[model samples]
Target: MRNVGAFACGLLFGLGLIVSGMANPAKVLAFLDLAGHWDPSLAFVMAGAVAVAGIGFRLARTRSASILGAPMQLPTARRIDPRLIAGALVFGAGWGLAGFCPGPALVSAASGQPRAWLFVAAMLAGMALFAALERLAAVRAQRSQSSS
Candidate 1:
């Protein structure tokens, strides 16, 4: 039941992205072209999304469990640290360059977009690299602890 609900939500989200032109790299790039022929259509879409998410988060914060009977796992981090800044910079750079963030990239990739496929592949490689580096760090930390 949970899997079905998740699939349904994901499908709806993908459809929304497609309908909003977010799945199209050209449209996204046009939106990002602030100095050039800027398209402000996506700003409305983003504003609407932010508004909805804000309300949802507010409501979620009052709840101990999700509507699905699962624990409500929300982000607890509030401080903007160096890691957060670096991550935001990397994310912004990728989005600006490729014109496809993770969600939209996944939608476009599923629709067989070549550039989206490349983006998703690179995204997966980055995730893998990060995981490997984290593992190496953990191993070094463990070794140091054991040696001491």
Candidate 2:
């Protein structure tokens, strides 16, 4: 039942993205373009999303567990570090270039668009590379600690 609810939620979100023109890369590109033919429609969508998410977060905070009886696992990080800034820059650049963030990219890929497929492929490759690099760094750090 919980899995079904999760699936329903995902489906609703994808549908909302499609309906809001968020699944369209061109629309997203237009939204990001400030000096060019910019579209401000997505700003309203984003505002609505943020407002709803804020309300949901407030409501969720009142509960110890989710509707499915599972404890909520939220990020506890509050400090903005170099890694966070770098990651935000990378993410913003990726979104501006590809015009597709993770959720919208996945939704767009369902439409059989070549651009969407390429974006998803590159995104997966980036994720894999990052993981590998992090693992290597951890191993090096552990070895250095043991030697010292």
lDDT of 1 by residue, 1-148 (tens): 8888899999999999999999988999999999999999999999998999999999999999988888999999899999899999999999999999999999999999999999999999999999999999999999999999
Give the lDDT of residue 30 in candidate 2. Answer: 100
Point to the candidate with the largest TM-score: 2
**Looking at model 2, which ten-residue stretch has the lowest summed lDDT?**
68-77
Provide TM-scores for the models: 0.95, 0.97
Candidate 2 lDDT tens digits, 1-148: 9999899999999999999999998999999999999999999999999999999989988888999988987768999999999999999999999999999999889989889999999999999999999999999999999999
TM-score of 1: 0.95
- Clashing residue pairs found in predicted model 2: none
Clashing pairs in 1: none
The local distance difference test score of model 2 is 0.95
lDDT of 1 at 29: 93
